[model samples]
Target: MEELLKTLNNIRSLRLLAKEIPLEQLETILKKFELVVQERKEEEEAQQLVLAAHQEKIEKYKELLKSEGISPEELLEVMNLHRFNPSQHKKRAPRPAKYKYTDLDGSQKTWTGQGRTPKAIQIQLDKGVTLESFEI
Candidate 1:
């Protein structure tokens, strides 16, 4: 691709510098360019046909749903209810607490010891208290 682009650039520079290209060579280049344009047009038309077919199928399904008294919104809601959304997974049961302590406010609290150290535990630890001392 890079070499093709370089060749094209060289041809462009030559065209700019030359007084005229020979008629036969110019005709040959024009024919190749026209073939490329025709191929592109055919590919575009094929894509349009595929898109039109897909749209037609969608419209037909919509009409069928309407005939059966189901609105598009209802269909979408039903689909969402059955969809396997990652966030909708059943939550794991809470981990059992591993430590118990009393807060500054005199309320009991427990920790699974998986997250940040609780303020009550932190204060005791700051005073050289061992974490195992609070384990349940």
Candidate 2:
């Protein structure tokens, strides 16, 4: 890997290696490199086409906004007003416990009944006990 990296990084090393390689093997390597280059060029051209399409749409929107007597800056300000502000939003408070039960180790535990049932509660539930029996 290191030798490959050194050869790639140094033009002199690359030229020397290329000169030593058999013509047939060199032709095969060249063909593969050319294919890779063509693929990359096609990918770049596709991306450029997408960017051009986006630009065209943006221009059309700008013209529509102008016809409606609204400047881009004004539209941006209105959009910003409705945009979410994490600092201004408060996190919701945690839900209160809905059920209380004794664990297998004889310790009291509480659950909000939101997610998976506790193993201790599940064991009793499997034995025909009602889930409501553990209600807080």
Question: Which parts of model 1 have CA positions greater than 4 angstroms off?
Answer: 1-20, 90-136
Please provide, for model 2 over 1-136, each residue's C-alpha lDDT reduced to its tens digit, 9 standing for 90 to 100: 9989998789999899989999999899989989999999999999999999999999999999999999999999999999999989999999999999999999999999999999999999999999999998
lDDT of each: 0.91, 0.96
- How many pairs in model 2 have backbone atoms within 3 A of each other, for residues 3 or more apart or on separate chains, i.e. clashes? 0
CA lDDT for candidate 1: 0.91
TM-score of model 2 (CA atoms): 0.59
How far out, in Å, is residue 133 in model 2? 23
> Stretches of candidate 2 above 4 Å error?
1-6, 91-136
